[model samples]
Target: MEAFFYIVPSLMIAALLSGVWRLMRRSRRVARAWGGGRTAQARCLRSYTTTSGGGDTMVSTTLHHVYEFTTREGRAVRFEEANGPGTTLEGDLVTVHYAAGHPEEATATAPAPGRLLAESGCLLLFLGVAIAFCVLFMVTAHEMFAETDGLMP
Candidate 1:
């Protein structure tokens, strides 16, 4: 059981690192293929839904919000500006930045504070907890092995 715990963590970390590496490589490759143009913005529409269990009433909302622009070629990209709410409505026009080389490679011209913060926080928290657990497992396993081997006796 101790050995299993020790090995599982190492395997998990290895898998995670490999997956991240692959994603980064793929993102870079797509960015390069898009000619890297950075000036473009487009509006995206999203629909929100609300559900109620009382009676037979279900409500779905189709609100149009302007999402950050993304290029067709590379990985999706969105941008938000520092001023005002970065998100825009369906009919709202936004400026996008693109790579000059790839005029089609563009993102919205603003920063998405809420999305960025939430995503970053979740990622950090998950990684931190995962690593801590893995380290703890390793330490426990080492102690178990030492005791079983009569090293401390």
Candidate 2:
């Protein structure tokens, strides 16, 4: 029983490590693309929103924006990303970065290594860690109180 309770924090540690790995990978990818890519003028095609988790939990909404740009070789490329120019409407001009031959590998804006949603796993990790700590503390206190109950009587 107590062992089961300790598992929560152990799982949290794993999750935290996973999050750190994801964040590092994400940062590296962004840095690689932006650091070694060419810049082009992109146009906003359309933006859409998705909603989830309605019952028993707060509704979550995510907005996705799509952009179309032409590479140096005149190849047309369209990419969808969760992060892009905010409040930029359709047909608006935006900046994009992409490799010389790989137009599909592109990003609208250069996200800072520490700020990229970096979100990719940080948010989930934080939630997991918080829940795990709560569970651990609760289980520990319960055991302490339970053990002392007999002495009090």
List runs of model 1 lying over 4 Å from the truth: 1-3, 18-38, 41-96, 101-105, 108-110, 150-153
Tens digit of lDDT per residue, candidate 1, span 45-111?
4423333355567654333233455555655554332223334545566666556555433444344
Q: How far off is model 1, as Cα RMSD? A: 8.9
Clash number by candidate, in order: 19, 1
- Candidate 2 lDDT over residue span 47-102, tens digit each: 88888898999998777889998887888899988745568788888888766655
**Worst 10-residue stretch by lDDT in candidate 2?**
111-120
What TM-score does structure 2 among the candidates reach?
Answer: 0.63
Q: How many angstroms is residue 135 displaced in model 1 relative to the true structure, after the best TM-score fit?
A: 1.4
Candidate 2: residue 117 Cα off by (Å): 11
Candidate 2 residue spans exceeding 4 A from truth: 110-153
Q: How accurate locally is residue 98 in candidate 2, as Cα lDDT from 0 to 100?
A: 69
Task: Provide the RMSD of all predictions against the true structure, rounded to 1 decimal.
Answer: 8.9, 5.3
What C-alpha lDDT, on a 0 to 100 scale, does residue 113 get in candidate 1?
Answer: 44
Candidate 1 Cα deviation (angstroms), residue 24: 7.8
